[model samples]
Target: MTKNRWDNGITHHDGEAREFISTYFSQTGRRVLILASAGFDLRSTAVSRAIAQTGVTCRGIFIREERPNADQALRARADKNAEQLKIVVPDSKVVFIDIFDPVDQAVVGARRLTRDVLPILAEGEPPTDIVVDASALSIGISFPLVRLLDNLYGQKPGTPNVHLFVTEDPHQDDQVKPDHAERPMWVPGCDGDAGSDLKSKSIRLWIPQLVLYRTEALRRIHDFVDATETCPILPFPARDLRRGDVLLEHYRTLLIDTWEVDPRSYIFAAEREPLDLYRTLLRIDDARQKVYGQQGGSLMVLSPIGSKLLGLGALLAALDRDFPVAYLETVSYAAQLGAMKNLEPDDWPIVHLWLSGVPYA
Candidate 1:
């Protein structure tokens, strides 16, 4: 809202993303640090493969969740991805961070990152580029890391370039279902003041990213936040023209009946373009700022329960304004591995965005 630098950001898609990584990372004297998740999702290794194909060795940190109740097939797939990452980047030492508190399922991943990953970034030979594959990691895990990097390098010119990579497969995403979601709570560092301590005069705006089969989770968050205004974001100019319609119809009961969201309150942005969503959110916040600047200040709480690309957009916007992000972390998933086996690489579009660095400077 306040003169966002990434309003007109750089983004790449599909083969173009691969080409960018290959050409740019293959250059001489480039110290690249990649942080990705070791997950059962098919797109877990897409970015790593792209970087490895360029013959450019880089540091790797793969996040592993310690979920005892996880499906066997899913665990196998995550283990397989972790091994494949090692094989792909054979020259470098890949550190794995196990980020899960088995007892209470609290948000300890950020604490683990500070202990395990922060020292590496703060070393004398700091990385020149930090690439985060947001596809496999949950929003709770990825948002804090992104915020940390932004706070560390976003303001400093010629600092480490921060890049975001996400492999988007709408169909594949639809196939996987989240199960046993925890209560809605604020994400670690992005926790905005949605609690009881918030001032009574403050206007709260809730922006939720729409997706399929997340009604229950979203309902819980909506009740918790009790926002003054609701602006639900829908995917427009999507790969499928009917997606926006489908989502609106799917959520009609919740939006209209439950939340009483206005017809004119719908926000739409390109499906694969994070900057589109980023700019749209900033515009909304700009209006709030102008109207409520002299008041107690408006609070925008974001719920990104959709695509990883959209989640990245939400993270970028939150970093700029310190917007609160509320989410229900999944305790276990309910996915059928066989259902996703037939998916081809071409079906998923790999996206790469240059978030910050010398290029922008």
Candidate 2:
């Protein structure tokens, strides 16, 4: 059996990490807080250093895990890294929280910091923002933290903005050849069937941290407690418009509605499954006349065979229609002209619509 090796430095793949860091740099001058777990502490010193270099006020909350000698050594390494970070990012600050501590205590500590520590740190400074580095923690706790912050500091129409940056591990490539060259891979829709050229593939070598949010537009997120209470079916924010109706045309007229204007909006990175499915549906709707029939009537009210052919398309369209704009904002932002190809065979129809770029009803 081959022994797996673990390394403590950042690894680059697919240009994702670079893009993520660039996004933060673009948003410089905002007050930013980084909530980091042990994994992030290990993997993202470079990122932290980069943030500091931007001259933005950045703070890091490090979550420590209790362990024996070996673990202690790793913790010590992190501490050393933190110390080094202070030199590189003289303005940046750090706080350590032990995970072995009780959950209630941890929550209390986090709340006290957000409510008390952070504000004081800001010292009535103008233009403050917060970003949670939740890559290491389970979504269970991380998701709730986001909700808690929103509730504690209710978002005024245009007040001090808080940004939450939750980072996740990048997909791994286990198919390297004996020579260690990356296996040939292409994002089908992105470059089409011809396959990405060698230069594009080589430049693509950076693991991406999906920017789960666009800071300025995050109004409120449903709390974890409420989500758990409902379970299986997630509870979405209530929409003012009646079901089956299109969003008011006035919404499209807003300045933010124009392509590329707003900087402070919240954008989420949705799981590929849901986004792909939604895209497929949109494509089916777009090509309906060629594939099925006319597109005038409600796609939902079609015959059984037609509906199945459409499959999850109608359902996804309904979600986009009725749900608050935030639900699909990420899909809208990350949406490339042909980003939805290469979906699993079963998900083909839904991916087609999602890539078709049709606006939801």
Candidate 3:
């Protein structure tokens, strides 16, 4: 088997992440290109502010989700963040790409990004490093963007390295809810040929990251996948000791009655450590491959419906294994009225992962 790319990946959290941003540009001759969300979420411009403090010469592509029935307060907040992002990265060429089609409600983010941004990355004097702030950008957008950049520039020598950044706070995530969810669909660029019937002979093992308030999304995806086996990923050693237990109880009915997931198949990964989840998934897939390699074979399908940290881990594993990432695209996210009322800005810790770059070379 080929070695896992992120077996010893570079990652930083909290103060270390801030310090890395402060010194990264000064130490290396790299021009950075940051793609982040310009949403109502407080952490939308978090990474931008960190990079600005480093005096890095970089550009940004701020994603703005277009919602028709969005709350006025939330819309105002999004607008404010966009302005703040512009102020923080004053010298950089910044662009705003609107996601979610207004008419049919079909996710056109991947298509729009390919049309508007891919050319820029391929042009002369492209950025030497690409950073994606996945804190606020929905998985529908961030996953495809990261996959595209990696396929385009990360795998080759003298090409830009791809990095993922996020501000993680499970409490904050629990407060926000996705409303008006649409039917489940395969994430663009991470489909792994799931639609083809040629793989019907292969045994399908579905891995889903469990999260609060995402029961419906999980159910939709589970029914869509109809996998032969189900392995649920839960966060352990979490900030809240009872977090994993609470999630298990919340999804007890679905796990027991609906999906019929085995208790032995539950995966416990650290909430703060993305690499832990990465290594865990790699081991499980390796064992399965060993047993089914010469047979009809086996397929691992992942559904990342949890925290951004866990989602990053699932994204990494899917990229390495070429598995399908199934997800439920939301029609519109519910406005946060008072859910984040008591939370302070510092509650969310900044997280960073350097997926590929000079360090690996």
Point out the higher-scoring one by TM-score: 1 or 3: 3
TM-score of each predicted structure versus truth: 0.93, 0.37, 0.94
- The candidate scoring highest on lDDT is 3
In angstroms, the error of model 1 at 304 is 0.7
Model 3 misplaced stretches (Cα beyond 4 Å): 92-98, 122-124, 341-348
- TM-score, cand. 1 vs. native: 0.93
Clashing pairs in 1: none
Cα lDDT computed for each candidate against the true fold = 0.81, 0.31, 0.82
Candidate 2 runs further than 4 Å off = 1-29, 38-41, 57-70, 100-124, 138-141, 170-361
Model 1 local distance difference test score: 0.81
Instruction: Arrange candidates, best TM-score first.
Output: 3, 1, 2
- lDDT, candidate 3, equals 0.82
